[model samples]
Target: MRKLDEAHLCESVGDSTSTYFMKDQKSVTGLYTERQKNHFLVHSVACLGTEMHLAACPLEFNKGNATASCPGGVLPAVVSCIPGPLYTHSLALKKKLKTTTSVRLKGGTHQGEGRVEVLRGSEWGTVCDDRWNLQAASVVCRELGFGSAKEALTGARMGQGVGPIHMNEVQCSGQERSIWNCRFKNITSEDCQHTEDASVRCNTPYMGFHKMVRITGGRSQYEGRVEVLSLDVNRTQRWGLLCGEGWSTREAMVVCRQLGLGYANHGLQETWYWDGSNVTDMAWSGVKCVGDELALSQCQRHKVFSCQKTATRFAAGVICSETASDLVLNAPLVQQTVYIEDRPLHMLYCAAEEDCLSKSAAKANWPYGHRRLLRFSSEIRNIGRADFKPKAGRHSWVWHACHGHYHSMDIFTHYDLLSLNGSKVAEGHKASFCLEDSECQDGVAKRYECANFGDQGITVGCWDLYRHDIDCQWVDITDVKPGNYIFQVVINPNFEVAESDFTNNAMKCNCKYDGHRIWLHNCHIGDAFSEEAERKFEKYPGQLNNQITRK
Candidate 1:
């Protein structure tokens, strides 16, 4: 997510009715678990699923311990319910939804995941991955009577299809019931290939997967230390902690999915601060996943109980969210506008004040030396549903005496030059002095402006552009040796803001420096290519550095 500051993103929650009916797993019940001193044990609770809240159910609390209220294997109530779809498309698209005979999914392992194919006339075709996103994929999901998309895959992730490419650059508002109701570009033969076919994983019916695992000691329902319920050799059920060692976002993603949480904002490896759970037995360890698993138990793990740290403070935890912003840099723009500028120190007063130049500049003669700056334009687009707002409000914005503007965020972006092994050679940053809508789509009116101390934020369908001429937009590479390197631009590098997908927040380009000049090529988003292609890119040989950079 291209966020303005190092803080968790937040959105206001409004009262709304849930779309699906849900029930807990019988194996794990409320009455069987450990309880706090002040916690109540409600008994004989019964009500139809249609009730808005548990308060509507006939409930009675135990006067003492849980054993006194419930006995004879009478654990907490285990309900059986057939859940409906978690979401539906807009009612305004009712008429268009009926005409969804055009689109279909294929080659899926399950019902709601597959390569998206559309019918052009009577012949089935596929969609190009260009500009394909969750918004457009959600439309197709709802059209197929499923919930919103869990993943909008690209580059034929579900497998390639053989047919004409019917659509390119699909743009949907996510409210449309069908992909046909959204704006799109007609595909040209040269515009797309079968290799770029789009695919999706839509949200399916509730399966009570969340009941098997849970988060405890979080400030909200979306965050906490992870605990899983599993049976021992004697078939006795117990809840235990997952080892924090080697835990990462991929593991967190599976946990969130299993828990019916939207997405994993953070895969925290430590839970020392969350004091809610006293369970300290490390039941699992060495869990590794590719991030598409439906359950944590399905992930690869060590056969024996093993952990570097067995303490409860080292338990795996997660912070989940229903929505988050996603930021993508304009790769083509970065390639088209990259150049070197030997800026005189006298003219870099503002840049110096902002600490944009390399640290070696401090030892140079007063306003005499020229700093070789690698300049490029950065265009950050918020592709997520949530607006990208500054974590700190106006009251906390820091004023910059030199720039004569308020710095809304401490660090908005990071521009770096990295070696082949991914060690940083040099770096620069764009402090968010002004974050406003630099431009918007055709129908998206500008909602943020930096002029006259106006509201600052990048709304959906809008972008914030930092031109090459702007101060602090370039990495100072004067002290570095000229050789092959990677030019990487990381948005929200600190993960300060919550984003739907942090994997795509980085844009990288192959760079070759030859003392006097620099060349950049193959600039693309981090997740734009396949794993194999990315591996080859990372291991790119030095011999290939002689080629002319693409314009």
Candidate 2:
């Protein structure tokens, strides 16, 4: 009984199975069902005609059965259809429909913040900064998935744009979705010039090469030592320390943004407070930034770099804001792919060395028991505005001969099968996962991959999907008996990495087992529901579980 736009609808049903119906009827009808034993069914009908308003009555059905059924047989639902055709065609059929135009930022090294340009009739054009403002610039920022405009620049601040100046006197109310929706004047050759080309510094999401950097060694989350991961000519990912020489607030600002933290309160060239880790190899020196760039690589550096202080004590450090990095589990995939498999103990030597098995496994006889593993596909998405990189460098990454891939972080994700009272019965852990773009949104390309030891990290608008068949993606539940339990998955369990919001990081599902086959339902994002609803979800034992709720 609610209206939804295409974008919101896609997000809501993204993890669920859905069906769409399109018919040449006067009205469109829909039926929705809630996931509960005694649920409500609301039926709605709307007009199919474009630009026509129609009102339909909502019919509510009260049912005792879990599945929806028509008790009184098929009811003839009627709606107040407007007296008009489905679509209205103008008499001037010769007029062509407006073709879609494209926008891009040039000159700047990063995406979202750059010189303004438009694509028209297969030709790229520019915008004249006659009356450009933050309002107009924000429209472009929003269209590019950035937050808003931080600054609306003019006089070729990001360098002059080439080709025709197609727009001038641009104005926006700041609420428009795109620059095309705003009011602007079409320009001729004499109306405007490239010297006045408009540029925008958008409050864009932290992305690109900046994702490969991390901060460590500080006492608090805000204050930390600095490190970076880079790819060598050999295609091997390596992590090394940074020389603190010439490090300033400008460089710290980029670091804070890359880590999803706010602006830098203090950038330190030398810090003896946090030298706990063994990472002392200096890989960069003479690092400089403009305080506006997204990544350190975008900053200026000396052609031939060397560090005066070879010690890690002189490494770069920064005190950033409290807010950074947020990780969340893919709830839909857990419910759909959860299954059980039996693995031999003889084949678990690498897992044992990695401490993936429980402490009890150490005391058991060598290669004795068959571990009943609860396996499922997990898609850990970096939904926050910034990328999530491992805090450790490649020197510390563990290479598993059996897996043939390096583990980047010591502890990345935690999986557990807990009793109703919150008692843990079985557990699993994923160590130092390699980040890659399993999928990305339109206009974005897959950059990082684990293949060839490439740079590994999750970029904004990208996700790292671990299939159900992958090694160590399961809980060793060989000891648990047949009963009701809660299946919980927590991403970035250790506070080693920072995130913007940590509330949505945990996902839980209701599970039922009977020695052989198992069923998981009611899977949902941890913070999506209220505390009371979560308490109810955890309290109820899965004796007669039948519905999967979508919140």
Candidate 3:
């Protein structure tokens, strides 16, 4: 039976008398019934080679006598075995089951550190902190295409998890293919909580490269002044600024990627805007990069490392990104705050000096026409991942003595009252705005402000809320007659600053007026609804008789 099994025989059939001639007496002592004998032979042969079922294996029946019929009238039965293909289907199935699962870090600014989550089946869940250590974390780091673990964190340092706790008390030997292959306890509701979620900071090679160079004084990681660390003859490490006299976007790309911030948007040679830091020593100068190097140290530099000007103002800055920022208007505030007011000509001197008045106001005689203003509040928010910075630097900002502030960009928002035929009846413009963080979400603090000569720009996760009471937040509608018109407000109209999207920057409202008062309703975001929905919104009948008067 063992030899037949090794031969890969599928099945065999024999009569009961054939068992007497077997070499091993103990192996072939089954029941003597014809059906039972046939079943035993078939099953024994099938189970020998690859454990195949009897029905799946080929069977050969032996009906002829062994010696052409015994001479003494005693017939001898023959035993025959047949072979089939080997049963090796489990090998392919095992390979299929060994595919790696998805893994990622959550709530981290960069890629190498965060709360660890593994995708199981269809849901993504967190790992518990029980017995979590660097050995287990190394497996996770390697599984995620990074290096070994630098630190295995606990107590939810990366923020709390939201889904099920997939694993607990994980014990890895530091050589497993994945964290899943390591021994772990299956988690139950009582086993863990999100506050005890396991996290890891992987030891990435790029991190060492990033540590060799850094950016400082900018609002976010994407935009900052460049600084590099140098080792002296004694092997002492010191941080110093890079001379920005000849810095270009090509050089900036290498700096940003070396710091793991993706690609470069703009490489600034003179970054007075980011000069808030006090590090002023210049180390390397005349850096020439092809934009493909992994580290700034690999780039070409001047042989003598001399700088024409060593001031911090000549420091290099970079704007790194995979995409640009996206600016959007707060549509609800525009509808609720629309009103018309009359201002005397004497109060319009500041608006005229800042160029906030219409084009005709520039040529108007002194103190002649009273400016009729259509005023509303606007809340512009930077919803992108990066801050919205002005393209112009501090030197380019125009100082307005009338408002006592500097305008960074010439045109920020556009206000227009259009006729039914889309002709501009009266238009208003907001001069270069002083971008500041008016409010922010929870856990975020305001960083930029227009007051006290502070840095002006909208930070990420922050909004600039222009109240209705602020000066010059009105449209000079003094030239338009009392009639129905389309009130449109477009934020970031000039696109002087880069943004991820510009399609959602405009908002429109239906307006009706009778010279003394005005009514605005059905204000909505320009890109929030479909074109058909917008057409329906515009087709709604306006109540021209109703007027909400404001003094």
**Which candidate's TM-score is highest?**
1
Q: Could you give candidate 3's per-residue lDDT for residues 1-551 as a string of tens digits?
A: 22332222212323331221112212233212221222122222222211112333344322332122222333222343211111112566545444344666754434467788876643457899999998788778766655567789997776555546788999987667688889998878788986788999875532367888889889887888998998655898888898988888778877876777865678888988785667788878999986556678878998777888788888888888854455778877888888887877787898777766778787777787577788888888765556777777877788877788888888888888888667888887886557899998666688888887678888766789888766778888777788877888988775456554455678888888888898787565565443444555555525321321111
TM-score of each: 0.56, 0.46, 0.44
- For model 1, the stretches where C-alpha displacement exceeds 4 angstroms are 1-186, 189-208, 215-255, 264-319, 391-396, 451-455, 541-551
lDDT string, candidate 1, 100-122, tens digits: 56687754545577789876543
Residue 269 in model 3: shift from native, Å? 15
How close to the true structure is residue 458 of candidate 1, measured as C-alpha lDDT? 88
Instruction: Give the per-residue lDDT digits (tens) of candidate 2, residues 357-455.
Output: 777778777888767789999987664445667766768787887667898987888999999889899999987557788887555577788888888
What is the lDDT of every predicted structure here? 0.74, 0.67, 0.68
Candidate 1 least-lDDT 10 residues: 6-15
RMSD of each: 16.3, 25.5, 20.9
